[model samples]
Target: MTSQHEKNTGEFLGATHLEGCLFTGEWKPRTLTAPVMEPATGDQLALIALADPDQVAQSAQSASIIQKQWAATSPAARADILAKAVEVLAEQTSEVAQWLIREGGGAHMKANFEIAVTIKALRLAAALPEQAQGLVLPSVEGQTSFARRKPRGLIGIISPFNFPLYLAMRAVAPALALGNGVILKPDPRTAICGGHVIARIFELAGLPKGLLHVLPGGGEVGEALCSDPHIAMIQFTGSTGAGRAVGQLAGRHLKKVSLELGGKNPLIVLDDADIEAAAANAAWGAYLHQGQICMATGRILVHESIARAFTDRLAEKARAIKVGNPVSEEIFNGPLINQRQADHARSIVDETLSQGGILEAGGSGEGLFYQPTVLSGVRPGMRAFDEEVFGPVAVVTTFRTEDEAVTLANMTDYGLSASVFSKDIARAMRIGDCLHVGLLHINEQTVGDDVVNPFGGVGASGNGATIGGPANLDEFTEWQWVTQRDVPTAYPI
Candidate 1:
């Protein structure tokens, strides 16, 4: 039986058998299991299988075979199934929202937004079947020739803990829509909501069995997905360090790979900007999901003239946001996914403070809840400014000129997302052009996104591969050239 989450209570129960792997049209419960704990209370909610390499290969083989059959079906058939999946998922929005909060520590609004985006992504996938367009090419000697998009065989998708469902679907939906089989390796920490639930949704939507396999495993599982011969490509979303390893391993196997890595994004606040509005965006960008998002505003660059005003207003908002157990409280902020993450965030704050960074507000924490933190006078050469903290800590740095702001914004090796805030739209556009990132916004925060747009990054943030809209048609498939002739042409020889 598939695992089910108990609303209001942190319990994940399966019938007589607790299933972790969804393979070959069945939920298979394994022998060895790891606890899936609630981040808020450190309670063990359920147990998921720790998949081995052999099991991964078996699932990969199954998906590859099933994908061919699914791909052979008409494009209209694929679109209809995806459309059904969207409807099924929409009907169970409340259940998905609870899983988001309990498993990943997202607040209510964040949960709702995630649900909406996920549904939107599925709808986009529904359109991809018809949009996987082919081009007729001019052929020599009156021969008819064309290039068409074809599925890239089986695809290996490794999703992260934060925004588990959306990130997974960011790759999964497109792969399925484009007639590719999927071997999903969601982070073990969020297996149920991120992995099996996706399988369940598609199953309820009438997707053919075994086309998708939800295998929640650790590094070994990811390694198998990267190295397995059955998987044609690997789409990974996680830290740069981890992404590097995936890229390197997948490279050895001669497999196509997409790495959506870490980011140290920036938000430039000009003196002309409204202090309150800017502060709200900063708080949202830095503290939403406790800043666990890869696109979280890593640093804020402000015009030196209004540096103090921005910092003070930002600090006030930082302290104003309530942090608590997401399941039991009405709060904007929640736990840090696990004790280790909380400890790492705390250590970064301590190190930043000891390194001469001044704490404007929230330098304290208890257990997993680190208060929304703000550090001012934070400049280059400080941990808070240099590293990807991935916590609810906002680092404030001042720039003397527009050139300096651009320099500070592009200082990081990461180039995921950034934003420019100014009342003057022209100035905002000018500043935004100077920044190097995949997604840039004017008068908006760096944290937000719409799945309908092309999404990915450059340099350390991503390998230039994108997900969403027409881009997915390319990301999930390869090109094939077909030629036909009424009469046989003479051989060149």
Candidate 2:
């Protein structure tokens, strides 16, 4: 029987041992290598080949060649291939989820959920080709005019470590379905599962060679992809700072770019909200996967009348969460991605406490593991209230009026997602409308996404472009207007 390393090397990389980037259907080694470590154990899992600027250029050129051919292929064929990819992904869900848990430091349930969402995204992308339609325009009596969607050639996808599979496929599936070749630069931390696993699945689904390339590395590789002229567009998911760099690079090249960046999302619990239900959703939204999600509830805005009750229940729920090994089925909170993140979370909590915030639940753990923490009496000046803490810490702030709640919710530079929980649908909707976020949830958690809905943000969160559903196709394609006249027309001159 093959060991884990041997199996990953042979099956995933097609080499005796994992070596380098998968460029244009070939496994090529790089001069430099980065070590991929398991966050939970702090053990080196493998060394991934880091792609330099020259290698990034080569991958872009090759993708350009393949994209032209793919774009010329029939839409029906593309849709069919995407449909087959869904089946291939479904078969490997368990294996992929295991990789996510080990490499990404995610809970088992969270990993599985990521895989499930990826499958749904694939299915949604499969139907896009058939549903894609152009519009007829009114024209002069003797002329006809219309617009059609055309592929944008090569798309460069830079995905984050958290929810790597789902984030990568969120762009990959749609780009492929729309007949565009993709160069995927997954996070160096999740190269094995996010980059290697995805490449293998697409190959099994019968995607033509060179159409999908996985070049796993650090920021240098992403910089190369973003700056390459051959790459027509870039779809990125990461922190606001990183997204800013990507946007700047893409803008310099005059290329289309879509960014799904950081979020200091808020969850508002109105006085009329069910206290138990609000607390439960808050726990799930803020503590799931140790709160590494971009849309995790960073701030909880509760009505003054119920703030104490809500904070009490939220603290109780946080204390009960199993914070341990990600592989354990009973565990809900897992380790952060690395020591730095864990340290960052701790520092944030300490700063909040220093600023006169109350720590009601937990504030201590070992190594990369951080306990689920709840902070009350958090004010605007506190770091926990103003900054995005991508950890299992929920900061609660009390507001006396609905206006104050909306003001508090929209008080951050980040505006990715927000949730309003109230028994009255109209009241919840009113609050949600006032929050300056890209996605708003009513009577639900902020950490939620649908494959058929537009997923992105505004302000510092991201650029205006979106991913998922029909928007996916729109993001990867351009419109071409065609006009025809049966008879010759006279020139103005």
Error of 1 at 214 (Å): 0.8
Candidate 1 lDDT over 1-493, as tens digits, reads: 1334332322223442234434446777678788888889887766776678998888888778899999998999999999998998888888778878988988998899988999999998998888737899998876999999999999999999999989998899989998999989889899877886787778777888889888888898899999999999999999999999999999999998888989999999998999889989988999989999999999999998998988999999998899998889989999998888888889989998998999999988999889999998888998999899888999999999999999999898999999998999999999898898998989889987678788888989988747776678878999999999988998999
> Tens-digit lDDT track for model 2 on 62-165?
88998899989888998899999999888877767777888888887888888889999999888888874678899999999999988898999999898888
User: Pairs clashing in candidate 1?
Assistant: none
Candidate 1: lDDT of 95? 71
Provide the TM-score for each candidate, comma-separated. Answer: 0.96, 0.96
Worst lDDT run of 10 residues, candidate 1, spans: 9-18
